[model samples]
Target: MKTVYIGTYPPRRCGIGTFTQNLLQAMSGKDDSPKSKKGFFVVAMNDFDQEYDYPEEVGFTIRQECQRDYQEAAEYINLSGADCCILEHEFGIFGGRNGVYILSLLHRLKIPLIVTLHTVLKTPSYEQKEILQRICRTANRVVVMSHHAVEFLEDIYDVPKEKIAYIEHGVPDYKFLQQEAKKEFKLDKRKVLLTFGFVSRNKGIETAIKALPEVVKKHPEVLYVVLGKTHPHVLHYVGEEYRNYLIQLVSELHLENNVVFIDKFASQPELFKYLYAADIYLTPYLNEAQITSGTLSYAVGVGCPVVSTPYWHAVELLADDRGILFDFSNHAQLADILIDLLDHPEKRLRLSRNAYEYGREITWPKIGAKYNNLVKEVTAEQLKIPRKKSIPFDIKILPPFSLAHVKRLTDHTGIIQHTKFGIPNLKEGYCLDDNARALIMALMAYKETKSQKALEFCPVYLSFIYYMQNDDGTFHNFLNFDRTFVEEQGSEDSFGRAIWALGYMLDNAPNDSYSQIGKYMLDKSVPVFDNLRSVRSIANVILGISYYLKNNMGDDVMIERLRKLTAFLVEEYRQNSHADWKWYEILFAYDNGLLPLAMLHAADILKDEEVRRIAFESMQFLSDITLKEGYLSIIGNEKWYHREDTRSDFAQQPVDAMCMVLMFYQAYKMTDNIDYLKKLFASFMWFLGENDLRLSLYNYETEGCFDGLEREGISRNQGAESTLAYLISYLVVLEAHKNYYSKYWQQNQTEDLTSNE
Candidate 1:
């Protein structure tokens, strides 16, 4: 079975790059025939602007920061005829914040995936933890070198234990040549102490350097060799500052004769020679968080007795006298341990014997065979599972309807405008915009489910709208929890939303009392529509007026009102819109889909073909921009996208996603097009986890949706606006499922019964 590996490869100086090259070599094994190499290849990751003269096995190259490159790389792998893909996952190796851009490629892969996590932090940043969790979900098996990493994955990241595979870091298969290697490296007369791998400040080389003075005083013939070049990224950004400091410390301590810095990357044969030459391997890493250390593994594998700081990897690898551990940056303690080990040659030999016995299990060939087995197993399982020819146009995959969050956010005063995570933030208080949205959501829930609990919320949210309205019919936008208005006049958007709620209630009220109250408020607000200039405001009012006309078709005054509003919106489209830019405004901002939705409603109400034409044209434009990726990537609210500017990818808000879902639902209803139904479901899924981040914004635990998608991660606050938007989109999808999928199923059932009769 051929496998494709995705990561940094040889000819790049990165540690992960070297590891990939070694893994590929080991997995291909002693069979050097063409059959062994057939169809097995590497998709190398290039650091920004740096290209490699890679071997033919490197099938594709992804620029670290170019997101499009990752997508194209996946397409290449999908068509490469490789049975499975193994990804080497290191946070900084991929592009975007915490390397989030890799998700795009992972999502597109058609083959089975296995990801080897090189680093698993005990305490991770929000983006780091979320990105790792997403990767775990995508991979069929998550490989980690240390058992500590496995525990972290299950406990910290919540990855299932069955999904995780504990595979030790592969080490080179070589015999012990401590004295012979010392002679080959020309250190036969001098006792050698070695530390290797790409040198960085975090390696805590100074502690080892500082410890050398005492070691040399005790054994003047000792040679402390620091092998490998400075880390490439560190060299690029900070130059040789870290290397220089080590040299300076050695100079100040007058141990320059005993200490040596071999500033170059070693070949595998040479690296093993250096490992064999060592009396002991030292990895004085300052942080205890290092989950896996390949350098340390190589030392233990070669039977080189190791003395290292108690990093997570060392603690486990050195446990039960396999090796020795020293305190981080504790030079005196390290020095004392080195002296004792040197004095007792038998103790060092015993440690080496234990290390070699343990290393036999993790030799590169054995580890490679283990990986080969995992790949075959995953590929076979994938082949056994039948592939679905097409996605079903139904809600079978959608989560069940939930209003637990809505109830939590709602008090007698109405749904709170904001939340601190899942809890309602009283300091932010209530807003008419959210209350209007909440009212409409309640009405949809009550209509869809006929739940008395849902019906009960209608009056609560309706009461909030009544409380926010001024005597002039204009509404107050914000209200404190103490029942005081923050503003005398609300924005046109809030006014429009209030009208939408009232109009929807008038058409689908639970009782005559609600209809009477809705009609009274809607009638009082009629004068505001004539003066409405904001396209979004007019669109909201137009939608409300159309809903009102559904119950009052004979009301020509309302009909004229609808006609004038549609005309204004159409005129706005004609004036500001061009062939390339088919929008009511030059810039696309929040709640953009509302514009086309209003026109669609008006077109159906008045049967105006021209209005319908513009609506469809503009809706197509919106869909082309947002749904072009085959998933809903909502227009971000960060300095909104203009006609000629580069569109921002974030922060994507749920309200925008909700608008898309609602608009597409309307489009499907008008055209009976299955494509619209597909787009509608895709937009709705943006809440569940199908968007840019691939991290679910809707928290199932709280049943509350996150506020938005920032570039770094999902905004943690589960505000009322986002939560309400999620519910509204969810209900619309459910309604569509009932109307289309459920109805179709019922039709099939009826035909089956008739045939039996």
Candidate 2:
């Protein structure tokens, strides 16, 4: 009995073994045939004690043995061959450096050895070069499926030209194999492009994605089917990194509607079914090999029109009469091909039929006869023996980070705000730059209208920004966007915004339990306080607000730290700080009110004259940053990021509503300066209500947040948030009502707004 093993057998579960088993079954069949000499085959160098049924037809046998020694096994198999021996040689499955043992065994067989080169190396390694050279010296015949490969090896290696035999990879014959059905839509309507095969790094799935815009315009239905996952061995060189890179590129390009990545394995029959569904088959591969294309063969075998890179092997297949050979280096050219192919339907059918005609001639019986001829010739020859050993195999499996300690992880959060996605924690695959404005919009809407949907975005935004805060409060740039949903913690400014949002949410929310949770989490953190600008500013800000809300100052250290932070704000915003006063003003104004509240608490506790000075100075910046227009101007150049028509759209201008809110309350408490209070009140109403209450709802947009306008008769600006901002705007007008019963407001909307409260 002779055993030939291919895939991982018995104990190991692998795809290649499954393919090999099917191949064996096709050769052996259900009933034993006297004409066939095929027997139990374990083609593997190392055999597991366990045995797995081939599931091939029947009457088949497997001769198994432990390959303690490869060269010895080769000699034993050769001596016992009683006929011939075949070895399946692929650079990936067999050990690169030790792969020569397969050839050495062929040498020992001398009776006749036919080696099937499973893979043709486009980028052959040093060990691969050495093995190919040794195989050249030993094997009586080499079987290659590609003609280009015959020429390539002839030029690259010292192998005899006549010694190599070419037999195309086989595909099962099926109906619809030769038919190119009229597209559901007009042939020119859309491009239903398809990609099926192992998805590996160099396979360049992204190239196809980048070309989608052009394809879609020509054929709107240019749907892409990324039919299968990758070969296990392919990941060793490329790793799972490329898979992620491709996914992000797809998202960034907004191809979610056109591209469908089916990360599943398909059988031979299923593969054909998928191909038949496509308008054009795409193989935008970066690498070209002379050897073989299992996928291309399948596509062509089923008469699918293709658009592929002009690799040496691809040239051979299509040079005769197949499909278009394009430059793999140019992305636009590849996309253009797809566009052209989708536009020309009859042309595609003509080429597809021609390729399938070629495929049909490649029957297993003919291929087996080639093998028989090689074996006959090899057995007739005399040869010397060589010694070698068995090979090892391994798989790539990333260790899982079980979220078993989710609470343990969340426990590290400074304030248990909410679940954040696509924010500061990078949300893995979600792009922060893409969502920053959206994030801000979501938060502002949450604050203004208090909509459930808007408020719900709070946890998401907080989680997005907070996950970046490590134990030590530092941030990373990248995170596992897939396996790990949240990734790198980014810049300080990003964190600061997140921190401010968290504080604002914590301060105003009616939820007391969450407030307590925030205080606790902050307390348990890695004791990060006024250390760095990014870390300290935000940390102290949270603590100051937390102490005020909880009415609990744990220790004097925190109180002192808060004072120092207030002092830093004061010094940072000195009248001559730089740029415009507004930049410093926004930060100062933001810190001013909270710091004053902190200072007020300290004044009651420490009785420090310095604390009183800082509190007073903090409140003073509001007046300094105010413009003559009764509104606080943005910091720096107002024209920096605005359209001419969109006046008062200061890119860095200070926010008038917030400044007025702070100043009006302060003036009311400070003295009988009713004028200051009145001014603050008028500014709030005029500035906020001037836009027709436009800024009220945050003018929601398509970016999944309240960012821009609601002009399409769509009341995007209405929600929990619109209600909140309106509520605040209404409060100011109410306060000024007692002083001035402005006839203009009453003549129109003012009376109704006033009555709203």
Q: Which number leads on lDDT?
A: 1
Per-residue alpha-carbon lDDT of model 1 for 26-94, expressed as tens digits?
Answer: 888655454666668999999867999988888899998887788899899988888899999998888
Against the true structure, what is each candidate's TM-score?
0.86, 0.44
| Reference-based lDDT, residue 150, model 2 | 73
Clashes of 1: 0
- Report how far off residue 45 is in candidate 2 (Å): 6.4
lDDT digits (tens) for residues 421-513 of candidate 2: 211232324322222222343444444445565454445544544454466654432334442434455554444433444444555444675
RMSD of each: 3.9, 30.0
Clashes of each: 0, 41
**Model 1 RMSD, rounded to 1 decimal:** 3.9
